[model samples]
Target chain A: MKQKTLALLTLGIIFGGIFLTMIVGAWTTENTKTPARYTTGSAEGEYNPEDIRGSYTLGEVSTLFDIPTEVLIKAFNLPLDTNPDTFKTKDLESLYSIVAEDIEVGNESVQVFVALYNDLPMVLTDTYLPTQAVELLLSLDRSWSQETIDYLNAHSVIVTISEDSESDKDSALATNESKEPDAESTETNNTTNNSTSTTTSTAQEATTAPKTEPKTEVTTETTTEHKEPLIKGTTTFQQLLDAGIEKAQI
Target chain B: MSKLFKNQPKTLQKKLSIRHYVQFFFFALIGLIAINHTLVETGAGIPFLSDASLHALCPFGGVVTLYNLATLGTFIQKIHMSSSILMILIFILAILVGPVFCSFVCPLGSFQEFLGKIGKTLFKKRYNHFIPQKVHDVLKYLRYVVLILVVYVTAKSGYLMFADIDPYNALFSFWSDEVSVKALIVLGITAILSLFVERPWCKYACPYGALLGLSNKVRIFKIKRVEATCVSCNKCTTVCPMNIDVANKTTVTDLQCISCMACTSEESCPVPETVTLTLEPLNIKKPVSANLNQ
Candidate 1:
């Protein structure tokens, strides 16, 4: 090919490909905003914890993770009147900017909190959670592993609110003292998880306080019972039928 | 005294080559897009204009994120599907006709060439000749090392590590807050060096250029010299920006060839079709020796 022909062809291919992708809706120049979901294993279809970003709003988090908005507001000690819809997770940085040194709380702290609340596995980094979040998690009726309790205990940062004349408060750090989380005292989190799954009103009531009474047997999909069978590779239809599904269902 | 008209009719200014137009088009397009991106971020951009970030438009982002995409099924933050598409298209172009993207599309290469004009005027013949041939030869391979290191680090960290030192981003998105100080410094150094060396960054530090340079060895259409009708005035070699000896080589399989065609018959060669970029290898017959029977 002539040099001129080659040059024009190069431009055509590049710009043409871009144009084609644009037409086909594949040419995205920004992130999808929605976090990536797990594509394989037991967590398939569940949103990946690591894919969360600082741009996510508290309301968006509540919707995506099935976590209550009130619970998130309480966990982070956000202002009662603050709308979760407009509250960006990244705002936590400036909100806690005046906190004591060596212990920082930010978006990663939210990721940690969400992961622990939903019992989703997440890669633990040097992320420190706010003490309120840790306490909120402990107060719920959920069974946490000893290792997780230890992790929460070690990584919690106590943020104290100091209101100014304008009523704008900074989540200030009071002290660096490490306090043990009371995980065993709460029997309501697991019971709440069951009741919350049953009705919207019960879920709202469960978020009000940690119920002390022993609850009915929980039937909601716990982390351990959520795995579904996946047919893969050379698994035949005959084998699938024998395993139990009817031909009509298949 | 009427107007002095003793000199011969002025020659027509040399026509801007197709390659120059292409280069300028991309350079301007990217510049506008980058600026528009900043404007859009502030909620004050032209509604019809695109506001894609430099990383999204850059094919090098696709190259660096290949490992991450393969293992994690996601591009590095800030890079999007457009980069991957451009990367694939450029790869296809490279396999067909060598690294035309470097010469015809990359704004950075065009920017360096623009600076080189000043270098040519100031230094004359001494321009692009300061480096010793042996040292130049060794330094050219450094880009490959850079390519490997960038890919490894980006893969390991699941982030675009190259952005920290990418002079291309620094040049195009200098006004943006995303431009790193190290990248700005590298761009400054490149700009200064362009006054001495031709494509200093492409020859030494551009990881993407290093990746595309490999295409020269196996490109379907190559820069081939017809030795049969060649008047070896060495004009082709002299015009080669990469300092390749195009006059001597029957075929330019050099890794540094950017398919700029500066050394081709259509551009610098005095003899038509002598130094041509063609798909066919030239068929020049060997001369019979007169004293073979002795």
Candidate 2:
């Protein structure tokens, strides 16, 4: 046969095989329906809002900690229904707390893991941790507070914290412990008038104040002593190291 | 004596290969059937085939689908087959590959090219000058606009307009006795145009080809001319179904070349190592000659 004829024949055979395969694939293959349910326990679990617990559905974890659910599901090989509702309240809350702590320490993977863990419900099994998540947690933002630092250290995790030079540690500690007296007195008076309002306000203030105070201290210290505006939102170095220590426990 | 006689070129034998024209006829036949099927409901007229259905007979479509899946993040679904990503990728690939789907793969393109050869033979003098370069270039862009419009309408309305209008589908359906009127219209227009000009639809109307032409400049595999060896023969240029001037340039002109390799074939351009397809850089020193020694 001529080379052209042979080449054409070869092409025809190859195309014929491919055509047959395609026909088989399309004909035998049921028109791909939107899976009534995604494959459970596949590399990645599907996202279903129904899996989340209570009113707290998994919003954008990526925004909070830059963790994609798709990555977590694939990495962990989590079950399909392993959503936020499936996890015990304690597990979910603990996961949330851990993520918060990881944020303080700047541990990326731990933060992602916690986010993913929190999103999963308590019931489903086959959980796995991603190496990327672990790597990310180990390299956290180092400027955490002393409380966070102490917590991390006790947990046996190490972290670097940015320090505040202007902060007279001794005075700041004294002020933190002492300044509460005036605020507590005012709070007490308000509590007597409207206990519910006072409690809610106090809780909100307590959560927010701690985060901001440490940031302010770091900024002040960086400007006065380090000659820089210590990267904002970073916990004091002591706090971050402590946060890492706390994570080591889990 | 018979061998010697056979070796001598007779007047009819000197004509371009009839195989391409035959292939072109088959393409037109298919197109006609497709259009007829679209117009009528008789299963015996022309088979009507959907992209999904034809996907069974043509593995190339499946390969194309897989390519769409990888690049476009498409999930295969039955009811809503939105391979927008695939469509986009096809467009992008067309820009880079010079509408290869049309030139080499598309049965429709093959048919059109075949008809174009016939048009060349019948209207030798009148059809000598094809569409003007600038007008051709502008018209080439129409496919993108059509693609965009078709895709937008399909996405928004959830209808497969292209599938209905595609001549290839119309032709494939002819065997099954199912034809699509829209598809038939498209095929009819394409066939009529082919009679007037060589591969007219490919040059001006094929949206897919338009995209390929845009990307032809960056294709990894391209044709290069060895100017020094060229006997300045314009035979390559004349024989080009797409009306490209293959003799002059180092690189195949972006708008004209389809990588069919017809011009480079031994029978077409008998230059010794003059025109070649290569992945390597072109040498600029050698100037292409216009006349062939033959």
Q: Could you say which candidate leads in TM-score?
A: 1
TM-score of 2: 0.43
lDDT of 2 by residue, B196-244 (tens): 7777766766655655566666765466777878888787887677767
> Each candidate: what lDDT?
0.73, 0.43
- Give a tens-digit lDDT track for model 1, residues B115-143: 88767766767889999889999999999
Clashing pairs in 1: A140-A189, A141-A188, A141-A189, A141-A190
Per-residue lDDT of A89 in model 1: 77
**Backbone clash count, each prediction separately:** 4, 66
Summing lDDT over every window of 10 consecutive residues in candidate 1 chain B, give the lowest-scoring window: B3-12
Segments in model 1 whose C-alpha atoms lie over 4 Å from true places: A38-45, A54-58, A68-113, A126-250, B1-15, B281-294
Worst 10 residues of 2 chain B by lDDT: B76-85
